[model samples]
Target chain A: MPATLAEKILQQHCDEQITGPGQIVRCRLSLVLANDITAPLAIKSFKKMGAAGVFDKDKVTIVADHFTPNKDIESAEQVKVCREFAKEMGITHYFEGGNVGVEHALLPELGLVGPGDVVIGADSHTCTYGGLGAFATGMGSTDVAAGMALGETWFKVPPTIQVILTGELRQWVGAKDLMLALIGTIGVSGALYKALEFVGPLASTLSVEGRMTMSNMAIEAGGKVGLFAADDKTLAYAAAHGRKGDKAIAADAGAAYERVVTIDATGMEPQIACPHLPDNVKPVSAVAGLKVDQAVIGSCTNGRIEDLREAAAILKGRKVSKDVRTIILPATPNIWRQALAEGLIETFMDAGCIVGPATCGPCLGGHMGILAGGERAIATTNRNFKGRMGSLESEVYLSGPAAAAAAAIAGEIIDPAKV
Target chain B: MYHGTAHTVGAHIDTDAIIPARFLVTTDPAELGANCMEGLEAGWIKKVKNGDIMVAGENFGCGSSREHAPVALLGAGIPVVIAHSFARIFYRNGFNMGLVLLEIGDDVSKIHDGDELKVDADTGVINNVTTGQTIQCKPVPPFMKGILDKGGLIPYVQDRLAERA
Candidate 1:
């Protein structure tokens, strides 16, 4: 039987031969990840289980990214727990403050994950690695602790949903717009307990960074994994990251799919996920001139070098509106350093934007740019559920980097075509 | 088997609403219980008592992979969560924390807020005592049931490691 990309990876990891979907199989994990918020609990579970040591010190990665540079004394204590555990266990990939970046963005850059591997993290966005053709999913702290101790976990194989993309995206519209449009069409729970496989012409053309942006939000649609077949772009990306081993993984031509949906990407306008729900999407034209008190361009969703460059292009010679405060955060330390070398940081600062460190602070209302009562913000981050970035009285509009930059200048949601 | 009053909510009740980020600094279950659902329905914590069931629409516990979301509810004496569907991570987290969940589909609408329900985990049955209607839910898989029997993944792993030794 021909297998899908997800099936092929699962079969490779499964301890015994598997028949099909819904079969429980034990999978050997290539990587296990947790951040400050989730790692402390995982560590406690590890100790309680009487596990003498991590199954493989090299396979476990812990980073202090969320609530880092500690938001409060309690947060400070949490980081301390993770730090002590990492030191005692001699975990190879532990990242401390000032060195930490969003785990989803930083892991691939460090060549810790690659195609045809099964990975799990205690953070939901762990699916981002699917851009590199890996089968990665998020689990709870206890599950992660078991994986850390045993080096293997169980999974019930999921059916696959094929999403075929055709035609070229319009200018100024990027992956963020494409993803928002997809969620809107499918509703929030459309892909519950299923795998979403991206294929066709447009999928092959998307940059790895763009693929990451799409895969990172797979959870938003209630998907198990959002996958793109490893092609030339994927191989080149892994090679650039210094990954040297196997070539990219691809599905058999005759692989079966539970359902197929085709999306035409031509002339699609920059889209926005309105306040309260990610699937509540509309084109920028529909909500034009809606005032914004703040604008943010960062998070694992769009906080890459390419995203920063796109925002920098829009804000190069323009000043932000006096009523709006703009903030830019590069997703990883490498991206931040590269942005500095390219003068993108200076461009943002000269345009009246505040540049923050590589942390997930403002994205989850952890800190940094939280909103006040009745405030509104345009951001490149995922999730705009009520009170997602601050007070329940506040609102958030989700958009791509370029649209967020343009909104900062106009102090309102604006069509990037007009910028 | 257990019986309780059902407290209902709509779809996409996210983890941020279950236990908001502002209160995520601590891992203490009691602290989390006090703030659970505080973001969505203030004073909900005060109303909840021991042995209540939470019934929700599709995609319950969506957003973020915070186990604290389920911990908060469990701490507030919510031992079971019944929904039309759940986000994948949350489903696994609930079991790992020894919190029971039943996926009852459209039958969820038949049970109203404050209605009495008697849930039987072994047989996958939820009986609406108030309306006298019985709904069939999908049974938990054998492996997951084994973990829950051991009171979550930690003890399950401990037992397995002991067997190996």
Candidate 2:
């Protein structure tokens, strides 16, 4: 009766006794999520399907993060649609305007997701909740609609890949580098149609926020979800945010994994994913001195308070290069408030960085900071796919917050330690 | 048989490349269609004729959970897509939208741009008139077959809920 963590969590949802990968079963969901860009479409579908109301208003969540603060008339209309729908449905977890933050970060910050929960969001980064030992994955808006009305949907249990991490990461190297290293090792399609299970000594040591960063980019590897054991750190994070879980969750000892990949974290330096692909990774040393016109230090992937603190620590007494326009976005309002409380905001302001509100802006090239033709940016956000942050000719270099902060100071990509 | 002319692209054509974030403002299919693949290559939509089959190397539709990616393709007159593989989200999105996606593994390379292809959705059989080859696609499971028959997930869910009622 042994099963992978994903299999166990999925089974718990449907109470299906026997199943394997590739077999579909209908499972209940702990949370059904959508956002400004996606919720409008889902609402349309929910109406098209003739559903008068949601299965459970409390379980449904809508966050206006993407293209929000009303980027344009069109995006404004999209948010309005979501707003009206949430109002009409009397949805408990609707977030917009001042309350809005990046969905993945805000959801975990609110403790809306915890161990053993099955979550599906219209945004791909929904899998970020896997940091709390939840089985979360992204679905299309249409899928979210069906899930909202029915409170359940079909799931194909994915095979698991055991990612064994050993040794400790060197200073200035952290979760983003580890994940970028893994994605580089696996290519973009390396973990397609599979769940990634993180284990080994290093897994227990990574902070919950760092683990969230690790799980946030699971989609970058084409993974169904990325999971860690619900150990003490996870419980503590949950409790701090007002969630309670009775027990820890982990894969059964004899659970099956389709593949085993080991990543040696010792002596590893900061990693960067170059232009066009996340799997197109290189050690920071490999691509030093690449000029950066913009340095963005936020997104759902690397926009937590911890990430900002790392950037602040580097920028404390230093100023960003006059040639570089550095932008920092704290992921949630609480994180933003915390950063303000800790005076990280003052450090960033003194260092010449533009502090923006908690929106997924600039990360998706929606607004805030856009790249011109032939311009390049060094960012702590996930994904460097071609033209992701602006002009098709504009290049994006993905890095950890330290490298991003250092790049802001140097006006080019460089080793953080050297700065 | 679903028939179309082929248009082949290389590997890892991400969702951002399929439809950029800037064009995601509307759920209108035509709006999404006009900007389809504009992120990867300009003038991509102009290349499509009605009922054209888009072919690609591995991991087509590899980023984001935007159903808009597949919706854009369908809106752009690409009713069928044959690729060596697909990322998890796009595969599900395509099926959920009732778009035909056939996984032909490496045999997808046998199809050249502008090749005439007739694909059988039920049998996973592909006939390439340009190469004179018969290729087998990765078969759809019976459960997913039912969803496709129902014209995607919404209609399928409606029927299932009706049965329960």
Candidate 3:
């Protein structure tokens, strides 16, 4: 059987010879990840297993990205659990404080993950690695503990859905807008338990960062993973990040697809997902001029250097509206330093933006910025679920950095092209 | 076999609705259960009794991969969740936390809120005692059944390691 990119990768990792969907396979994981929020529970489960030690210390990476610096006493204690466990276990890749960022962004930049690898993380956005042609999925803490204990886990191969992107994006439109439009068309649960393979001209043209933005939100559409084929762009990205031994992973010419959807991106407008559901997408033209109390431009989804540059271009000489508070977070410390070197940090500060540490921050309502009652925000994050950024009554509008930056200046949602 | 009264919800009841982000500060299952479903329908935790069943439309437990979602439901005494389908992570998380989940497709509409249900894990049959209607569900795969039988993946792995030793 001709295999999709996801299936082809899984076949290599599967303990059994399987080439099709729905086959139960035990896969040897190349990497297992857990963050401060999930790792403590995973360590507890690992201890409960009474395992002498982790299956492979080098393959396990523990990061304190969420609630970093500790939000409160309870959060501090939770992180302490991970720190002590990592130290005692002698985990080689443990990262905290200045070295930490959103795990999804930090891991790839550090070359800890690459194509054809089967990775599992306790964080749901683990699917982000699929941008590099890896078969990565999120599991629970206990499941991650099992992976740590046994170095392998089981999966029921999922059918594949091909999303063919044609034509080029219009000015001011990027992957965030494209992904929001795709999710709106598919609805939240359209691809439940399925793999989404992004292909065709537009997908191929997307930068590695753009592909990460798309793959990171595959979960928003209830997809098991969103995959992009490894090409020159992918190999170059891996090489730039110090990764060697990059392999090309792609779907066979006649791979079976359960369904195919083609999106024409020619002249596509910047899009936004309205509060409460990621699928509630509308073009910026539709919701423009709605007042916003805050604007955020960072998360695992859109906190890469490319996203920062886009936002900096829009906010270069303009000041944020006095009525709105704008918060910007670089996804990783390295991205932060790069932004500083490029003077993007100074430009943001001149625009009345508050640039914070590289952390999940307000994206998870953990800390740094929290919306008050009845407040509204525009953010470049994957999720805008109710109370995702603050008070349950507060609303979040999801968009690309351009739209988010424009919203900060206007104190309301606006079409970036019209800016 | 287990019998329970059903508490129902609509499609896409996400994990944020199951246990909002504000309550994710602790890993204690009991602490989480006290506030489960507070985001969607307030005071829902009070309504859930031991052995009560939850029925919902498609994509139940969608959104963040917080294990707290299932741990809270299990802690709140929901023995099983019957939905049209489940998001992948939540399905696996539920099993890892020892929560039983059934995917009943279109048959989900036949079961209503407050309906009494008897679920047989071995046969994958759900009997709506209130309406006296029976709906068949996909049986749990052998490997997953073994995990559930052992009370979740942690114990399952521990037993496997013990056997090897």
Which model is ahead, 2 or 3, in terms of DockQ?
Answer: 2
Docking class of 1: high
* CA-lDDT, candidates in order: 0.90, 0.91, 0.90
Tell me the spans in candidate 2 whose CA falls farther than 4 Å from its real position. Answer: none
lDDT order, best first, reads 2, 3, 1
For model 3, how does the per-residue alpha-carbon lDDT over A168-274 read when each residue is reduced to its tens digit? 88878999888898999999998889999999999999999899899999999999899999999999999999999989989999999999988888878899999
Q: A337-387 in candidate 1: lDDT tens per residue?
A: 999999999999999999999899989999999999899999999999889
Residue pair clashes in candidate 3 = none
List the candidate 1 regions with Cα displacement exceeding 4 Å. Answer: B163-165
DockQ of each: 0.82, 0.82, 0.72
Candidate 3, residues B1-165: lDDT per residue as tens digits? 989999999988988889987777788888998898987877877987899999999999888888889989987888899999998899999988778899999999999889999999678899999999999997888878877778778888888778767
Docking quality category of candidate 3 according to DockQ thresholds? medium
lDDT of 2 by residue, B1-165 (tens): 888899989999999999999999999999999999988988878978989999999999998899999999998988899999999989989988878899989898799999999988888899998889999998898888878878778888788677767
Clashes of each: 0, 0, 0
Residue A132 of model 2 has an lDDT of 87
